[model samples]
Target: MKGRQIILDQINGREAAALMVDGQLDDLLVEGDAPRPGTIYRAVADRPVKGQGGMFLKTPDGNVFLRQVKGLAPGDVMLVQVTGYAEPGKAIPVTQKVLFKSRYVIVTPDAPGINVSRSIHEEDERDRILEVAHEVSREEGVGLILRSACEGADRDEIAEDIANMLDLAEQVLADAEGAAEKLLDGDGPHLAAWRDWSEPAEVVTEAGSFDTHGVLDALEDAQGSRVSLESGVSLFVEPTRALVAVDVNTGGDTSPAAGTKANFAAARALPRALRVRGLGGQVVLDLAPMPKKDRRGFESALRSAFKRDPIDTTLVGWTPLGHFELQRKKARQELREVLK
Candidate 1:
């Protein structure tokens, strides 16, 4: 309970994985019905929306909408990858850029280069990983990216991962001429946990691990709109049809710095709240009443907090009415929707 622990369990007979750190739930992944991001497909081009500059494509799953529709024509066949979950009653979001990602390596079919993650800065380690990449017999245009997890990894494991990804990329790229069909299925919760959570942790795969590890309780708390920060400060994170609205409350604190303290706490806790709820898209924060001079500090705090988060989020700055805004990617389905 002191260190990181991964609990693999079933919620409502659906596959789910929970990451717990120091007896608290840090992250959660639950299976959903939408096509998972990173799935590859050989799709046939459908009609284009003239003003929107987007094109619809016919896939085995259904019709998907692709952006940046330059140099694509109707009836043309091409390969695409699912980018993220689509809104309700909307086409699945996709992109022409496809990538084969794994724990230690990512295969880039379009970009051509061998690069190591910047986190591994030692020259000797970088050189060793580069040599391992060079040993793989990849095609001319396909590129290789050595992830940060490759640092200090076994040579054989790195080489094997690279080789496996190259083979899979070659196979998928070769089958681009077929009808609209799925070329590859994305990784499920268990596999995704293995791929992304590379750090050493205790693994629990027994039945009812969620209850045993307190993940169920954490999830139950995440389902509510109120999140308690520190010193009786709390915030309400509610999702509306258009955006997520966060209202901060200072509670019973009546000190001169109460508003500032509450706002800063909200800034630090907002990312985790949104992440656990799997809420994304536009977000508006109605922070506690604070002086204008403290706005810079609040912005800095928010930016630093989001920088450590895994999901892609953009701090879109403050509005005219003193509301802070953010734009987050739809990386996961809404927790309420998934549960229902």
Candidate 2:
């Protein structure tokens, strides 16, 4: 209960995985209706949008939108991968760049290189991982990226992972000469948990693990709009059609520095809150009434917090109305939508 735990369970017959850290829900993954990111499709190109610089492609599931379409012509066949979840009634977002990602390595086609994770700072460790990568026989022009999980891992296990990924990539790429069809389905929640959550933790696979470990209760709290911070401070995170709106409040605290305190607390708690709730896209924060001089401090705190967050987020700076704006990638399905 005091350490990290990975709880795998089923909710409404859909696979779900929860990351509990020190008795609190840190992250969550729930299977949704859309195709998961990294699913590769051999698609037939459809009509290109006249002004958008993107084209629609016909996949087995449905039509998907691929951006940066420069040379793609109608009826041309190409391989594409799902990039992320699409909005309601929108085409699934996809990219021509497909990657075979595993726990220890990511096989990149069309990009040739062998690179170790920068986090493995020791020269010896880097060289060792590089040596292992070189030993694997892969197709020319295919790249290998050693993930951070390779650090301190068993050499044999790392090599096996790299080899397996490389094999899978080769297989998938070879099958790309066909008509519109799915080449590979993305990893499900259970496999994704094992693949992405590489940190040391106790694994729970029991049927009632979510309820037994209090993950259900934590998820209920995350679904709400209010997140309690330190002391009596709190923040309301409400997602609307256009953007997510966050309102930080000082609550009963009437001290002179209450606004600044609440702002900083909200800054620290915001990333985790959004992550667990699976909220993304444009995020606008309406912080407590702090002075202009404190804006820099709030921005610093927010930037630092998001730096630790795994999702890609751009701090777009403050609005003219004293609100902070952020553009976060829609990496996962929204919790409210997923549960419904």
Question: What tens-digit string does per-residue lDDT give for candidate 2 at 244-313?
Answer: 9999999999988999999999999999999999988899999899889999998999999998888899
At residue 40, give the lDDT of candidate 1: 94
Candidate 1 lDDT tens digits, 60-153: 9999999889988999999999988887778999998899999999999879999999989999999999999999845788888899899899
TM-score of each: 0.97, 0.97
Model 2 lDDT-worst window of ten: 131-140
What's the lDDT of the predicted structure labeled candidate 2?
A: 0.92
Query: Scored by Cα lDDT, where does model 1 land?
Result: 0.92
Model 1: worst 10 consecutive residues (lDDT sum): 136-145
TM for candidate 2 is 0.97
Backbone clashes, each candidate: 0, 0
